[model samples]
Target: MKYDFDYLIVGSGFGGSVSALRLAEKGYSVGVMEMGCRWETDTLPKTSWNIRRWMWKPWVGLRGFFNIRLFRHVMVLHGNAVGGGSITYANTLLVPKDSVWRDGSWSGLEDWESVMPGHFNTAKRMLGVTENRIMGPADILLKEAAEECGRGDSFYRTQVGVFFGDEGEVQGKRYPDPYFDGQGPERNSCIGCGGCMVGCRYNAKNSLDKNYLYLAERRGAQVFEETRVINIKPLNGGEGEQGYEVTTQSSRLFGGLLRKRRWRVRGVVVSASSLGTQELLFKLRDKGSLPNISDQLGRRVRTNAESLIGVRLPGDPEMDKGIAIGSGFYLDEHTHIEATRYPRGSDAIGFLLTALARGQPGYRRIFTWLRTLLKLLLTKPLLAAPLLLPFNMARQTLIFLCMQTLEGHIDLRYQRRWYWPFSKTLQSFGPKIPTFIPQANEFAFNMARRIGGLAGSVITEVLFDIPVTAHCMGGAAMGKTAEDGVIDSRGRVFGYQNLYVCDGAMLGANLGVNPSLTITALSEHTMSHIPPKQAA
Candidate 1:
């Protein structure tokens, strides 16, 4: 049967953009449904302080790229834009250890060690991956801290997806397309602005919109921005042999006059982030629109076992002058720590941080935090005032994003909350992810002490015993059968024809590093299984 498009991909992220580009290159007509605005360098926010254009709280009329979703167990930092999290994420891309293939539900499902390298190389080339070239104060601080802790050998520049034009050349210099032999957009060298997370106003960041999605559109893939997929039902008696009917509406909260639209697609790729894909699939299963979806839909969701710790130097340090996350080091075999930053004047995130408190979880941690605050107020009222405020946070503080390969997971359920009886939303359950990492906290404390500053942590960790993670991954993971996981090794959703998951939700293991590169490579792998349009 003829359909509106050969493939309809949800979310314009690392996964979705890769799928869109590869599928379009294979001669398939692709429709990319992105539930966010398309951002241009000129339109990007100057600082995260501009919440109206930097934060993504549609309920409150903020329609920016950065988003924070609070769950019972964790605070998830994600993004919403045409390029998804790449619009807000620090462009640190690193390959996970090979042992990841032997862990999690996807273990032994495929010869991942042998197969993933090629895809990684392809993703790297497309992403314009390179060793960070613009190290600034934060990188030096991280190296000093690593050396102070006697792990200096582990300190190294991160591999990132930023375009640095040339050695000794002026920064922000515009040039012809460098990665795709002029087939891609014109580029500019990074100017060491540390504004990647706020949105790269310099146009040096290799966001998907500048690469995969850009090339995909050039190849005739239609990207429908601000289009949110509300429902998807398989055609041909629910077997999806013919195609699927996808219903969508404007993503804007006040877009009531924008009537819902429907489209027919021969195949659907659910490339939304972990939370998004799981919530959508859960709603579909519960509503019986896609009842055949595996019961394991929301099981085994991982947060990359992450923790946020930092130091606030309070003055005279230009810490936020490099690329966001320019350097990192391993504290131990399992723990990886990266120096993270927002641009100068983007201090909004500091509202979530407070003086670091080291104690047990629950009431003990809260008590310790209270004591810390009390002591600071009593002894150093002047210093404590600015330290506690969000002002100068981006310029004066150094954030350590610590992640571990140690496995921990929470199950997401679509159910009504006690407070909100009107609707069932995605909620997290299971053993709580660790809110405190002793090594990371200790390192932060030592660094602060050495710099004559204050150590800090996410306030939620001390107040509510919940950690924050930007790298939320794994929900509809790969497994051997429908009973075991929601998708197969190749990302084909179990019990569904011509349906696939090609995002963080499909990641089965804790990567212990930024998952963008892995998600892109895995999406590439998933796309490889599909024959070209001629073969089909």
Candidate 2:
């Protein structure tokens, strides 16, 4: 019954980070394996133009548009790094509506809806969650727009994970353990560098290394970087089995490729985002690594009906250069828009908004996207980006994120030499979402019109009908029984013992908003079911 490790976690994002911290805190021997390496702020790819090196193609030598991969279900950005996805996530923390709990198959298990609050509160405290007291210029404008539209006071800043200063001089102030009780590392106030997504070169952003993973390592979990898990199989699973076996190989940071080497582990938790998790599990299933996996492996892969549209004013100065996601608006009950910014002149290829268009289930939506995208590609910068640039930000730029309530999903699979099981779902996986030009375009045009000194332009996206997904989920989802559920309420795989699937894959349904908070909370909840490794 002796196992190689108490827990072998694959992927080091929110789920893996939390699991490592908790298990290590409980005094279990944990082996955390990450497909990517450590990317500190300075090392992160800078500017949208240069970001492709790190974002599009992960690993040093790998090549291709696969680095910051886009897929049908979600846009897979941020790859192999010490902090996992936290390195590039916007750091906006939000809990799912109470409805998310009551709808999924896992709804019947105990009081998940009621119970999630405690976990949420606990997570918030650990992550230093707080509302933005000092609104960025972009957010300030959004609030004004909301008020003008008769929705005053409805505008509220997002509860970001960054630690701004007390006197609002966070612009250049540095503090030691400002949030933690002096046990954490020293931190500097955010300068609103507009680079959180590419990785915070400044220690201002609250990546896992700053807290969760930080504390976990201090407790004793070993995190292995640049290690891609190839497959996970049961060592001896049954009603009372003892351990699980995991295998992986070296992962290239670039070139958009993976070389299958060999390694092993006693237990495994798949925290490799949605696309990564789905592709890995599919290999386990199709390649026969873990055949007992449920037939519902790739169902309900959701896009959150997400869309991205920005309103910015280029060359106005003071543009972008602020917090990543400064403000969000509830355009209607189901639709929401956030005031987003990026360092001005970033990826200065010139197009402004990347508004998504959605249609009912199929190639029809793709058709709509093609027509709009062609216009975006052939258009001129003055012909495009400037119009989206808000008046105040016209010298710079303004961006809006247009997301909706429609629910769309996809599946991942495994194939041989040319199958692209990973490539198809991972590479070509450009956010295979819907198109909404008429509405989105109209909104963009009008917004530009309202605030302008001759604003005009268009929206665009990757050719061949691809989109981007930041918060990826599903591959293994929840269902009534082993027949459908990938794992039980405790997140343990239905038929396998000592094996569990955490990460976004466990997200049984859509949250219709940022899912980091929900994923972290679920991982925290799953920790309760993990029976302490019995005493020797």
Candidate 1, residues 1-536: lDDT per residue as tens digits?
Answer: 77899999999999999999999999999999998899999999898789999888776789899989999999999999999899999999999999999999999899999999999999999999999988799899889888988899999999999999989999989999999988999999999989999999988999999999999999999999988899999996666778899999887877734769989999999998998999999999988888999988999999889998888886659989999999999999999899999899999998998999878889787888889989988987776778789999999888899999998899999999999999999999999888989988888888888887888999899888999999989889999999889999999988889999999999998989899999999999999999989865
lDDT of 1 at 190: 93
lDDT of 2 by residue, 95-128 (tens): 7678777765567765887788998997888788
Q: Which candidate wins on lDDT? A: 1
lDDT agreement of model 1 with the native: 0.91
TM-score of 2: 0.85
Model-by-model lDDT, in order? Answer: 0.91, 0.66
Name model 1 segments beyond 4 Å from true.
none
Off by over 4 Å in 2: 51-53, 56-66, 72-78, 168-170, 236-240, 253-266, 312-314, 348-395, 415-432, 437-441, 453-466
- How well does candidate 2 score on lDDT at residue 260? 60
